[model samples]
Target: MWEQIRANKRNSILLLALMATVLALLGWFIGRAFSPDPAAGLFGIVIALFVWMILAMVSFAGGDAIFLAASKATPVTKDVHPQLFNVVEEMAIAAQLPMPKIYIINDPAPNAFATGRNPQKASVAITAGLLGRLNRDELQGVIAHEMSHILHRDILFVTVAGVMLGAIVLISEIFLRGMFFSSMSRRYSSRSRSSGGGQAQAIMLVVAIIAAILAPIMATLLYFALSRKREYLADAGAARLTRYPEGLASALEKLSQNTTPLSVANKVTAPMYIVNPLQKKGMKLSDLTSTHPPISERVRVLRGMAGASFADYSEAFRKTTKHSTPIPSSALKDEAVQIRSAGSQKSADSKKQIRDIGDIMQKTAGFHFVNCSCGLKMKVPPNYKAHQVKCPRCGKISAV
Candidate 1:
């Protein structure tokens, strides 16, 4: 685990440096396109540095808040959903990390994700549908997976990479638009024609055009590669934490079988989800552009685990993918933990579970729950203004 963390840190630094270099080159090319002076490249580097710093600060400070808001997730308490809270708490204890703030998205898509700058500041958010659909063990599996992400510092790494990738996209967009609309192109063209540096100017122009077109794509591919690897690591972590690879394997099956796409997930936040929330119908050309490894393949690897250990998962991954080591050699423990099934503790009452989840979501959304004398529970929305409401079950008036 320690080795994995160190490798991730190194990879993150490399990714950032690569992104920075791309940004600097793009800026330099644009500067050269606009002016003949060599000092223009340095000025462009300054602008790139400024943009990176500002965006990095914003992403570190407020990116999680922005993500939660964009997903329409409401803060949830243990009092609102004891089961979900208990699962998250159990995982946090197993991982030996601080409990993350919990949130619930109202959407029915079975998806969940964790985000924050560090473990101390981390948070976990799941859709109400996930709570309703998954059994206790399955929910624990999902939470454990997320907790692994927090423990491994994947959240911070991914967050920073995402911000840098966005920066690259923004810079590329501006350079492309400027090239199309600004007088810089015409000025450069006239200067190249009049001066002896025509070939050099034309070469720079081609490089700038190529950079503008490919920089974002390169950044995206790097981000996706990192995202996929972290997911496999997290899965291994969850299996070891819970001592039950089947729990997560089954959960993945359930998630993949569901056809509904998450309405709140966009390209920016899609990689954070446990399963790819975006629905795809047919064969994908390559996994290079995907935010996650194929769900079927992940499930196969998990199902193949003979015992709950990093070594076990590593072997499974090798067999399933026929390439690349999933677990670092230093991180693999010799003694394997046996899988403990939680089937006996899993609830079988689907309707009751659904009702419980609905009640919790309503409470999280600030709705008032009223239990009537007729043995009926009614929820009043925040927008409701009536002081007295009649119970729909028994036609008895109740004062708010």
Candidate 2:
């Protein structure tokens, strides 16, 4: 795992540097277009780097909160969902990580994600639909997968890369939009073409236009590539941490069956999800731009595992995807782990679970809950003026 973490850091540096190069080039060219002076290009580079640094600082300071807020996630205490808290704690202990703060997204999509700059600052959010759908073992597997992201330091790279990608996209959009609404491109092109060394200036202008147009697309491809590989590693980590590939395999299958799109999901946040939240149900995500690997293939890899070890996962991944081993060779040198037996199956009352999750959300939203002696529960809205409320089911008066 340490080797993997180190490799991840190396990859992070390399990838971020590549992304920064793209950003700087775009900025330089765009700057050159506005001003033929070569020093303007340097100024553009400085501005681009400055913008990136600002975004990185913001992401490092509070990116997790922003993501959670975008997802409409409500923080939960252990009492709100003991099962989830216990599972998270259990996995944290197994992974030797501090317990991450928990959040529940009210969406009815069976998806989850982990976010933060690092392990100690990390947080995990799961959709209510996922909680209602997966049994305890399946839930544990999902939690373990997220915990893996924290353990491997994937969160920091993701946050920084996402911020970098955002900066790139933002600059490109602004430049293109400015060119469209203003006469900048035409003015610069005609002026340069009429001036001395016009040919070189014109060529540079063309190159800058191309860079502005393709920079975001290229950066996105890079981000997606990094995201896809990490998903496989996280799955492997989940398998090893839980010693049960079937749990995640089954959970992925169930999540795949859900078609509801997460309302809060967008391009910037989509890659962070356990599954690609933007993917349509039954659609195979095999394209280069996909934020995640094909769910079917991931499930197959997990189900095909011979043991609950990194070596087993790498082999399974190789056999299933026909790709090179996803796990680092050094990490695969550990002792073999025997897969654990399946946990006891209990009937899941999905409707009841959803109701309980809803109650948790309402509580977070300032709704007060009162238990009636007649076995009825009443939820009083925060704006209600009355001090007491009568249960609709039993007509039992209960003080708020």
Candidate 3:
């Protein structure tokens, strides 16, 4: 997780540089198009930086709220929706996480999301359809998936990405307005036109206008790519926690098959839901550049891990994963309540749920001895006490 954070930090810095450069270039292109002032390019970069900082602060404090409000989700109580509350609570305990605040959207879509500045302040919201449709275990799997995200501390980047979408758009609009005051468009130099070289300036102004139009579209695509990556990570995390990948796999199938889109879904909040808010219409993966991984792709990975034990999941993750830090037993420690928040704030009757999940853990015996995705299985004695157990069949060691 620390490595993911460091990488994210690096990525954020690089993206900021890229955004600033893009904005500056557009500004320069525009300035050259018009009366040709070299200073205007610098002005665009400065404006973009100022807005990025302000947007970052807003995202830290209020971004989640804006998304929730946009989606018309209301904070939920146990009494209002016990199924959701129960499912979330049980999953939180299973994942060893604090109870995140619960919310329910009135919409009939089966989707959910986790958000907050940090885990302690985190909130998870679900749609009414999610409760009404999925069965207990499947719902548990779905919520567990969201809970995994909280544990991973992956919220800020997502929320910040969402905020940047809006900021870039606002910046784009401001660029367009610059045309009204420019004097380069006049044939005969209107009283307001400051044309030193009239017709050539008009062409530059036109090109600048086109760049303003295209800027938001490009930024939206970048945000889309981040969401896809985060979804993959979250899916993998869920499989690791439940040790039953099919739970989430089945849930994704249901979500993908369902055709009821969330009524309150807007461009801004589209990335918050488990599935795209627009999924009911069966859009192509190419059309989806938001919060969800391709449902098909996510399901494929989870089903592959269904028979996998925690150790099995970790090794696969480790192989292609750049970050080699072990999944601290602490991170996977009971109920995800500690070992940090796990810092996953969840939703419910904490003690009872935690105890129940612990009992389940103890009774749900037999971990993957090989813990490999290569279709190898090895069973150990019930009382096996090795720090690492190597699978005799595949010779893979699942460590203590």
Candidate 4:
């Protein structure tokens, strides 16, 4: 595990540096395009650094909270969903990680993600749809995957890389938007023509324009590549931790079949999810620009695993995806792990799951629950102004 962590750290640093370089270059060119002065290029770099620094600080300090807030996730207690909390606890123990905070998103899209600077500070947020859909074994698989992210320090790198990517995209957007204005373009052109180095300036401007257009695309590709690689590692880790690849494979199959769009999801936050929440229905995520690898491919890799070890996952990944696994050789050298048998526990019916999830969400939303003698459960909204409420099903008056 330590070997894997070390390798992941090394790879993360290299990727971050490359992303930073892209941001710096984009900043320099955009700055020079706006002003003919060479110093303006340096100024652009500073601006880029400033943006990066601000985002980095915000992410390091409270990134987990920011993402949870963005998703409208509310912190959940064990009582809300005993099985979900139990699975998280079980995975944390298996991963030998500190228990991470848990939250639930109200959205119907079945997705999840982990965020924090480190394991101790990490948080896992799951959509209500996920809690309501997955069975115990499936939920355990998902939690194990998230716990692996916290265990391997993947969240920190992801947060940092995401910030850098955002910086590059922001600068490029600003430059492109500025270009649409005649005055900005004419000002630079006039200055270039006034100097004897008009041709040289024109070339630089052209390069800058091209860079502005391509920088975001390039950064996005890098970010997606990094995200996809880590996901594979996380999946492997989950298999090892749970000793049941089919659990996760089945969960992934269900997640892919759901067509409901995630209400709070956007491109910026898409990569954090276990499955890319922004993926369009029927879209192939195997493409270069997608944040996540193809769900079908991931499922195939998991289902094909011969055992629960990293070595097994690597072999399966190679055979199924036709790509070299990202797992470190040292981690794969651990003792062989025999896959465990499937659990005998049967999950509640779909209607029960949905009802339980709704109850949890209502509690999270501060709705008061009043039990009526006629076997009717009255849910009073938080906004109810009355001191008393009547149950429609049982003509019973309940005190607020």
RMSD of each: 3.0, 2.7, 17.1, 2.8
Worst 10 residues of 4 by lDDT: 191-200
Every candidate's lDDT: 0.84, 0.88, 0.65, 0.87
User: Per-residue lDDT for 202-278 in model 1, tens only?
Assistant: 78777778988998898888888888888999999999999988888888888887888899998768889999889
Give residue 229's error in model 1 in angstroms: 0.3
TM-scores, each model vs. reference: 0.90, 0.91, 0.70, 0.91
Model 2, 200-240: lDDT tens per residue?
A: 77687778878998999999999999988899999999999
- Pairs that clash in candidate 2: none
* Candidates 1 and 2, the one with greater lDDT: 2
Superior candidate under TM-score, 1 versus 4 = 4
Model 4 bad stretches (over 4 Å): 34-38, 182-197, 368-375, 380-400
lDDT of 3 by residue, 40-72 (tens): 656655666677779889778787787777777
Q: Can you give the lDDT of residue 154 in candidate 3?
A: 65
Name the best candidate (by lDDT): 2
Order of quality (lDDT): 2, 4, 1, 3
User: How many angstroms is residue 378 displaced in model 3 relative to the true structure, after the best TM-score fit?
Assistant: 54
